[model samples]
Each structure stands twice: as structure tokens, then as C-alpha cells.
Target: MGRAIALGLPLLVVAEIAVFVLVGSWIGYPWAVLAVLAASFAGLMLLRREGMRAWRGFIAAANSGQHPGERVIDGIVGLGAGVLLTVPGFVTALTGLVLLFPPTRSVARRGVQRWTERRVSSAVAGDLFGPRKVRVRRGAPDVDGAIEGEIVEPR
Candidate 1:
């Protein structure tokens, strides 16, 4: 991840700059700048609207005794989209727009979830000292297993 970011960020910046120049040339530089600003404003408005919806959904889910995990994820993704839109790049703005839209957001959500889960598992597995596998058979102790009382010796 670190390596990818180190390399990808510079590449992204360069690409964005190139795109900006190309667009500015095609249109007028002033119009191009205004377009970018307009996109940013639109994105910010969308982010605020979606963010409020996400928060309300979270609260409703919690009140109903349901897990608000999906709502949290939505909020996070929305926030990311908002940030991307504010980055002053057409590429980033496009990506952010996709994330803000429901159809594309669903697809992106799955990818993000998988990536996050993989990263979390790798970190956790690396940190643990115990065996990774657990052997279980039908009729093997209770779910919590048996807890035997042991004497503690003080030094």
C-alpha cells in the first residue's frame, strides 16, 4: 500500500495536470477553471446531502437494533468522494461522481470492502502469535468451550 501510494500519487498528479492543460486548451482556460470550480461545488453539495442521509440511516438502524455497519461504510465512501471532488482534478472529480451515484457506488463499495477486509486480515494475522487454524468436530465442547478454574500463584 505504501509503495503503491508513493508511486501512484505522483503519477496521478501528473496525469491530472496534463488533463487540465488539455481541457483548458480545448475550451478556454477561464471556462476550464470555472468548470472545475462548478464540479467542486456540486460535489460538496452532494456530499452534504448524502452524508446527512447516511447519518440518519445509521441512527434509524441503531434504534431498530440493527447493525449500522453499512451506513458507516456509506458515510465513509461519501466523505472520500467529497474529498476527491475537492482535489482540483478532472480525473478525481469523475471518480468522485461515480462514488456519489448509487449504481457505481455499489460496485465501488464491494471493491473497497474486499480490499479493506484483506488488509485487516493481513494485519491481524501477522500480529497474532497463536495458531491460525482451529480444529472443530461435531459434539466438540460448547461454543465458549469449557473453562477450568485454576489456582493463581503470586510471586
Candidate 2:
């Protein structure tokens, strides 16, 4: 799987470059290039604004000593979106924008969860709730009895 993704990344990059060039040529290279630059800049601006808001909310959540798990997850996701938004391409910018928004991210999270549930061959009941460690059966308990996080581990 790792190898496949590694190989696929360059292929995707090539495809994106081809599309960019084709569209740029059709629209006139100067205008297309300018548009790409403008969109990338706009994306970065939006990311900065959203990130600030999310940070403020996180600070508030942490101040109250409430579960800050979701905020941390959102921060991680936002950071990734920030990186993608900086890439010079319409498709990546669109995806990055979708990820930057809360409603869209919620939908994406559900889709990813469904994918994960299907990938696992055997059901591990109380799996996420159970201790993640593999130790002596009678060793000290490890479950924190909390909704630890909202991180979506990549496939």
C-alpha cells in the first residue's frame, strides 16, 4: 500500500501538471498562470483566517478544561489543508477548501470512517475504547475512559 501511494503521488502530480498546462494554454498562459497564483494566494488567506478562528476556539475549549480532542484533530486537518492550499493547482485548491470548512470536513470524516469500517476484516468490539497497548492481561488498565481524539489515520 505504501509503495502504491508513493508511486501514485508522482503520477497524480504529472496529471495535475498536464491539466494545468492544457488549461493554461487554452486560456492563454499569462492569464491562466495569474489565475492559479491568485487562487493560491486567496486559499492561503482563507486558511489563515479559518486557522485563527479555530485557534481561538481551541484556546477557549482548553481554558475550560473540556475535551480538546476535536480541536486538535481540526488543527491537524487544517494544517494539511494549509499545505495543499499552497500548491499551485485548481483541483488541489478545491479539495483543500473543502477540507478547510467544517461541514465539508464532517462529511469527509463520515466517508473516511465508513471506508475504514469496511477495510477491517474482523470486528474488534470496543476496539477503539479498549486499551491500545498489548501487555500482560492482568497488568494495570490503560483505557482512559474518554473520547480520546478525532484523528483519521490514513489508509
Candidate 3:
């Protein structure tokens, strides 16, 4: 994953530059610059709005005795979308816009949840989202009783 990100960042930058140049050529440089500025402004507004909404949702979920993982994940996705839009790139702005919608946001949230579950330990995940079904196996007990042992100090 780290390697992919290392390579992907440069590629993304190149793609963004290419797209910007293409759009500028078609619509004129000034319009393209204005569009980028507009996108950045929109992104800032979205970030503020989503931040408030997420905080409210988190508080409501907690107060209602519901798991807050979903709301927390929603906030994470919203923040990601806002950051993506803030970055000066059309492709990222498009992606951020897609994530702003409810349906797409839900999908993104689910994907993030799955990715996190895979990366995080079950115990930790459970702690965050409450108890989850997990498989357990019993190991055979040691047949030999406790062995005599002494801690020796190293010189």
C-alpha cells in the first residue's frame, strides 16, 4: 500500500496538470483558474458544513445509545472529500463531489469500514464499535505442572 501511494502521488500530480492544461486550452486559462478557485471555495464551505453535521450526528448517536462508528466514518469520508476538493485538481474535485452525495458517501463509508476492519485488530475494532461476533478456539493446556524457575540478574 505504501509503495502504491509513493508511486500514485506523482502520477496523480501529472494527471492533474494534464487535465488542467487541457481544460485551460479549451476554455481559456482565466476560466480554468476561476474554476479551480470556485472548487476550493466550495470545498471550504463543504468542510465546515460537514464538520458541523458530523459532530451533531456523533453526539446524537452517543446520546441515543447507538454505536457511533457509522457517524464517525461518515465524518472521516466527509473530511476526505473536503480535503480532496481543497487540493487544486479537477479529478480530485470530481471525486470529492461524488463523495458529497448521500448514496456515494454511504458506499465510501462502507469501503472505509471494511478497509479499517481488515487493518485493525478485532479487539480494537470491537472496542470502537462495540462487541462483534468473533471466533475463538481453545488451546490445549500444558500437561506438565509449573516448572521451578528463578530470575537471574545479568551482570
Candidate 4:
């Protein structure tokens, strides 16, 4: 992940710079950079504040004795999105906004749900060091083959 990010960052920077140059040539460099900075900052601020609001709601639901695991996940997503929006790049900022938006995010969330279902379902999520999961169907086996509790003497 780190290596992917390290390599991708430079490419992203180059793309952003090209866009910046194009916009700067049309409008002026100072205004273009300022606009990008302002937009990124605004998006970050909005999502960060909204994420906090969602976190507070999650806490409230948890305190009410309800399962808030999904809320916690949303909080995590929101935090990541918020941070991404703060970065100085159009793509990153747009990705963050998509994550923050409910309609778009719901699709992303469903993908996550499917991934969790395949990779780690309830058994894995429920416990890490717990016993391995085993599914037994009906009529598999029973204790009727042996006498109850007491062992028979060897003939």
C-alpha cells in the first residue's frame, strides 16, 4: 500500500500540475492555485465537520444499547474521506466528496459489504482468537452409538 501510494503520488502530482497549468494559463497562476487550495480546504472542512456530526450520532446510538458497528465503519470512512479532501489534488478531493455523499457512498458501502461477506463474515468479525467455525447439518452424528456416560467393561 505504501509503495503504491509513493509511486501514485508523483503521477497524481503531475496530472494535477498539468491541469493547474492549463487553468492558470487561462485565468492566471495565482488565482488558479488559490482556487484549488480554497476548494480543497472548503471540502475538507465540510466533510470533517459532517463526519464529526455523524460520529456524535453514532455515539448516541451506541449509548442507547444498540449495535453501532456500521456507524463506526462510517466514521472511519468519513475520517479517511475528510483527510483525502484536504489534500491538494482534484482527483483526491473528488474521491473524498464521493465518499462523503450518501447516494454515491451507499454503492461504495455495498461493495465493502460484499467484500466483508467474502473475506470475513460474522464468524471472523465476532472473534479473532476464537475457535474455528464449523457448520454441521442435521443428522450428521449423535451419541446414540455409545451407552450413556458409563463405560462397559472389556470382555
Model 2, poorest ten-residue lDDT window? 125-134
Clashes by residue pair, model 2: none
Of candidates 3 and 2, the better by lDDT: 3
Q: How badly does each model clash, as a count of residue pairs? A: 0, 0, 0, 0
Q: Which pairs in model 1 have colliding backbones?
A: none
Each prediction's TM-score versus the true structure: 0.72, 0.61, 0.80, 0.64
lDDT of 2 by residue, 62-93 (tens): 78866554554466567667767778986777
Q: Best candidate, TM-score-wise? A: 3
Candidate lDDT (C-alpha), each? 0.74, 0.66, 0.84, 0.67
- Runs in model 4 deviating more than 4 A are 112-155
Candidate 4: worst-modelled 10 consecutive residues by lDDT: 146-155
Give lDDT tens digits, candidate 3, residues 19-38: 99999999999999999999
lDDT string for model 4 (61-101, tens) is 76886655456556666776777778876677778878978
Q: Which stretches of candidate 3 lie over 4 Å from their true place?
A: 130-155
- Count backbone clashes in candidate 1: 0
Which of 2 and 3 is ahead in TM-score?
3
- So what's the TM-score on candidate 4? 0.64
Pairwise TM-score winner, candidates 1 and 2: 1
The true-versus-predicted C-alpha distance at residue 119 of model 2, in Å, is: 16
Off by over 4 Å in 1: 119-155
Per-model RMSD to reference? 10.6, 9.2, 9.9, 11.2
